[model samples]
Target: MPYPDEAVGFMADGPESFGTFTKRAYKLKPFEEFDIDVKVEACGICGSDVHTVSGGWGEQLFPLCCGHEIVGTAVRVGPKVTTIKEGQRVGIGAQAYSCGECKQCRNGNENYCPVNSINTYGSKWPDTGIVSQGGYGSHVRAHEHWVFPIPEALETTNVAPMLCAGLTAFSRWYATVPGRGRRLALGAETWAISRSRAKEADAKKLGADGYIATAEEGWEKPHLTSFDLIVNCANSSKGFDLPRYLSMMDVHGRWISVGLPEEEGQVIKAQNLISNGVLIGATHIGNRQEMLAMLKLAAEKGLRSYVEEIQIGEEGLKQAMQRMKKGDVRYRFILTGYDKHFARDLKI
Candidate 1:
């Protein structure tokens, strides 16, 4: 299939008001080496989308398109692309390109590539200097490295958010610990995903064997069981007292921080962890192999992302972002209706 000259996408004029999202037609440049054009079937609404469009994180490039968890069929592939051919079902996530020769890339840690690491949206191509648009559009074009073949067992609608949320959670969970094909952990330690009391059911629905209600004022509740691993996914560390939480950890407990707090710097005293030998580590998105493994595990186990689907349009996309800002969605949101909304009459 030939590439469309232009693509229509929902774009916000500025960060001042993301509710002002409107459909706009933007010209598509020719596919470059290792690029694949995907006719987007579904795209997930991630918290990053809200932060980028709402100016909460920072001022972004105006008229920005911001969906990253994209699942689609490949409509076009760059001439130099060899591994992936057209018509393949695939997914694209947050990080786009990383210098292949870098040590991080060589070690299969491309997400940490120090040179030329670019995002799926709001990033520029180092060579062409063209800005990268995301999947809140008819289609998306990305380098092969950031794209992965979607497992056949997964539904596009359900698996879309896995490209981001699943990858994020799996990377933190699976990176350090290796397990069997479906079993990710093998009796290592008792791990429970903590959440605000409001999301207690969601935490359980996501397969948490244990729950911790931390939303209570001063978190007046005490943990009955101590965990060896606690992955921090909180959006805010506003009143996060490191010592109080650290007190609940057993010796050699590791708190992996993956959440990006809107407000920076909740103090952590070294003494808090000294007695227990607790460790704090941070991670971003996962490497390519990890993404495939995550998808495979998800498929084999029939693990579906908890998502609410909304039509792909100005109102639907805009409200999804706004709802994410207010923590309205259960777990994730998927944008549907791109095929019908961007009909053949409209540029795609």
Candidate 2:
């Protein structure tokens, strides 16, 4: 079978000016037996893309197209694949692949697989010797295992952000100690914090009895001693009084931080934990099992992602990235209007 020569979209070349992403083309890797080609219908813009392009995270490989929250139709499926047939509505999250034989993989924790764990973009594919591209382009070829079937009742745009941001929040919410009636206090910079009264909204969504927003003045004081768990999705480090916040948790409260702190060297004194019996931990992205479970929950609960739509053009992508940098999006942004040729051969 023949394949298209290239995909058209914006490509980032290290930390150059915003104009660097204009009118770029990237070569699509040769298809493999385990791959599923997707004609992208939507992709959510995420903060990680900005960090990668601006060199905020680290050195970035040039000629990269960064987007992970992808939703689309499976245009083609490899001969060896059986789970996802062509024409299936599907989505791919941040993680693209992992070595299936590793211990973490065996235990359903592919996100932490010790062997090569491929990211949706800006990461290398050890098996194919290709840099895994992303959903910013017209199409994406992902390993079948990473592709998830989008429920028939869900809209593509609404499900796009669930591929990353939604899943991140959901996974953390699910990991909290069950039956303890945990309360969540979201920090100020969380996307949820700024929109939708995050503390109360997420608390209700995650089955918490109550939540208090730390962003509002004097809101933190009344709720301090009422929570059993707190999840930090915001980027701030020093604004909150750590000792006081920790005291809010019950005797064995759990405090988990998911997003990176704005500044390095952010520290917490030992006395804070010692006096309050609070446990602090952090999480990376979800593994394959958690990813599947999250999708199931989203389907069952009618959970939807907040998203903005953008066209799949170079200028549109650049503008979307700029919006992401300024935190202008409500929760997520999904790219649409890609070429339709990739879906021509799909079979449902």
Put down candidate 1 lDDT per residue, 1-348, tens digits, no spaces. 223766678887776676667777765545788888888889998878877777767777667778899998898888888868799999999987888998999988899899888888888777667677788888788889889999899999999988877788778455555331123363343335454566666666766665666655555246522556666877777777777677666577667777777786677778767877877776788989989988998899888878899998878876777788778887788999888987763632
- Give the Cα-based TM-score of candidate 1 against the true structure: 0.90
Clashes per model (N, Cα, C within 3 A): 0, 0
Q: Which sections of candidate 1 miss by over 4 Å?
A: 1-3, 177-196, 216-225, 345-348
Q: Assess the local accuracy of residue 140 in candidate 1 as a C-alpha lDDT between 0 and 100.
A: 82
TM-score of each: 0.90, 0.84
Per-residue error (Å), model 1, residue 294: 0.3
Residue 39 of model 1, lDDT score = 86
RMSD of each: 3.1, 4.8
For candidate 2, write residues 132-204 as lDDT tens digits. Answer: 7788766788788889888787888888888887777666455543654333323221222232364466446
- Show pairs that collide, candidate 1: none
